[model samples]
Target: MKAKWRIVFLKEFRETMRDKRSLGLLLLFTLMYPVMLGVILNQQIKRATKPEREGIELAVIGAAQAPNLMVQLKQKNISVEQKGPMDEDAITQLLRSRKVVAVLRISDKFAENYQAMRPARVELWFDSAADNGARQRDIEEVLHAYNSSIASARLLAHGVSPATVAPLQLQRYDTGTTAARSAGLIGSILGFLFFPAFICGLSAAVDSTAGERERRSLEVLMSQPARTWELVTGKWLAAGALAVIGITLELFLAHAILSWLPLEEIGMSWRVTTFDLVMVCLASVPLSLFASAVQIAVAMNAKSFKEAQSMLSFVVMLPMIPGIAVSMLELKTALWMYAVPMLSNQTLLREIAKGEAIGALPFVLTFFSAMLPALAAVAFATWRMKSERYVLAV
Candidate 1:
C-alpha cells in the first residue's frame, strides 16, 4: 500500500514538472532572488559610501550681518553664495530648479539681534526631495561643530576656561554581538525577506494541481485509479520541492549581493547567515501548504480555470499585504506573535539571524497555528476531490 502511494506521489511530481510555466517559476525561485536583491543592496551601499565633498549652492537672503557665521561656514569649506535680496516666491523657484541647496532668509533684524546677543530667526528653504538628506545632515553637522567651536572660543575670550563649557561625556555601550545589530537593521528594511520561499512554493503548488483541476486534466488524473490523498500529497510535494529550490537559489543570490556588493554607496548594508536561511525555508513549509490548499479548495469549487485564477490571485498575494508595516514599523515580535502564520515565520527567521535561540513554545505554536489552516484547507480540498460533482462539474 505504501509503495503504491509512493508511485502515485512520484507520478504527480513528474507530471507537474512537464509544464513549462511550472518549471520556469520553479527555476526562477532558485535564480531570481539572489540576483534581484544583490543588485538593490549593492546600489544602496554605493549611495551610502559616496566620498564626502563640500560644495553646495546656498542662497543667503539676509544682510551681510553674520560675518562670524559666514567665516565659520567658509572654514568648513561651504561656499556661501549670497543671492541678493529675494522674496519667498523667487527663493522657492530657485530651490525648485535646483539653484541652491538651501536658501537662508534672514528676518532683517538678524544683525540687530546678533549685536544684542539674542537668537534671531532665519528661514531655510530647501527642495527636500533633491536633498537626499545625507548631504543636508553633513552640512548640519558642520554648522553644529562651527557653533560649538565659536561658543567655546567666546567662553575662553570671556576669561572662562574651555573646560567650564564642557559638562560630561556621553558614551554608548553595545554589549551584544555584531550579528544582533545587523539583524535589527535588516529586519526593519527587508520586511519582504522571508516571503519568497513561501510565495514561490505557493504559486507552483496551486498551478500544478488546482490549475490542472480548472483545466480539466486533473479530472483525467482523478478518473484514473490512483489513490486520492497520495495523488494530492505527491502534487503538493512537487510544488513544495520547486518552491524550496527556488527559495534556496534566491537566498544564495540575495546573500552574495548583500554580502559582497558596494552597499554603502546606496546608503545600505546587510548580512544574513546559512542558519537564517534554513529557518526561513523551514517556516515557509506551512505557508506554502496553506496557500496551495486554500487555492485547491477554492479552485475545486470553481467551474473554470479563469474563475479559479481570478479568485486565487488574492490568496497568492496574501502574504505580501503587511509588507510596508513589516519593513517600516520596527515592531517587536512576542511569543504570541508566533500564532500568526506569516508573522511567526518572520520572527523566527529574525531570531536565527541574530544567532538567538528560538524558544520551543513559539516554535510549536507558530507552526501549529499555520498547521490549523493548512489542515482545514487540505481536508476541504480532499473532500472536494472525492466528490463526483466537484470532480466533473461545469
Candidate 2:
C-alpha cells in the first residue's frame, strides 16, 4: 500500500550486510564445501595410494602339524593361529557362528598325504552365500599360492625345476591415460562439495524477506517510502550477492585443496582457469536466482520470524533430495540432466571441476528452467504481500 517497502528493503539489505551472522554464513558456505571436499579427496588419495592389505581374517587350526603350510600362509599375509586339529563338527559350527571370516582346518592326515603325494584337502569353511564375493576370491588366492608352492616342492622331488613347471607368465598393460580415468569420475564428488554453499544464500533470502513478513515487521517496513518490487529486488540481489560470495569461496577452496589431494594424483585438474571461474559464476546466476525465489516465497507464507526460520530450514534441506537421488540413480550428464535444476548443475559441475568442457546450452537451459519455479514463487509471494491479510496485518 506504501512506497515504504523500498525504504524497508534498503534498510534490510544494509542491515544484513552489516550483521555478523549473515557475513559468517556466506564465509562458511564458501569454506564449508572445500573443507568437505578436501576430506573426501584425502580419503580417496589414501585409498588409491595406500598399500594393499589382506582383508580376510583367516584362523588356521592344526598349524603346528603343518608348519610348512603355516609359514606359506603367513607369507601371503593370512593370519594363522595354531590349535589342536579341528574335527569336521568344530569347523562346521565356526562358519555358522561367524566366529571367523574363514576357518582353515588342516586335515589330521595332511603330513601323511603330502609325503605320499596323495591329494590332501585342507578344508576352508565359510558361507559363500553370506560373504562378499571379493572375500571368497581372496581366500581362494591364498590357498592357490600355498598349493603352487607345495606343487613346486613336489616337482623338485620329481627331479624338475620349479620354474620349468610353469615358466610362462602374464603381465598387465594399462592403456587408460590417468587424466581420462580421473576426469570420468571425480566431478560428482566435487559437485556434492560445491552445491550446499549456495543453499545458505537461499536460506538467507527466504528468511529475511518472507520471514520479515511473518514477523509483522513488514508493516513497519511498509510504513516507509519504498516500492514492493524494490523491497523484493534489493533483498533478492543481496541474497544473490551472498550466493556469489559463497560460490566464489567454494571455487577458490576447491582449487586450493585440489592440488593437495588425489584428484591431481589421479590426473584430473580442478584448477579454475579464468574462463572456468567465469563460467561457474555465470552458471551460478540461475541457481542463485531460483534459490532466492524459493526462500522468499516460502518465508512470505510464514506469520512469524520463527516460523520463517523453520520453513527455510526445511527449504535448505530440500536440495538434499536431488543430491541423493542423482547419486543413487548414477545418472551422468545426459541431455535431460541439464533440464533438471540442481541436478543438472550437480552433473555438469563435476565436468566443470575436472576442467572438462560442459556445453553452454545445458547451463542456459538449466538456468531458464529453474527460473520458472523461482518466478512462480516470486509471483505467489508478491501477491500475498499485496493481500489485505498481510498488508493490513489482520
The number of the candidate with the highest TM-score is 1
Worst 10 residues of 2 by lDDT: 47-56
- After superposition, the stretches of candidate 2 with alpha carbons farther than 4 Å from their true spots are 1-10, 47-112, 120-191, 214-217, 263-274, 353-356
What RMSD, rounded to one decimal, does every model reach?
Answer: 4.9, 6.4
Tens digits of lDDT, candidate 2, 337-358: 7777777666656666555566
Go through the candidates in order and give each one's C-alpha lDDT.
Answer: 0.65, 0.67
Q: How accurate is candidate 2 locally (lDDT)?
A: 0.67
* Count of residue pairs whose backbone atoms collide, per candidate: 21, 12
Task: Residues 363-384, candidate 1: write the lDDT tens digits.
Answer: 6776676778977877777777
Report lDDT (Cα) of residue 294, candidate 1.
Answer: 66
TM-score of every candidate: 0.72, 0.67
**Model 1 residue 25 distance off true place after TM-score fit, in angstroms:** 5.6
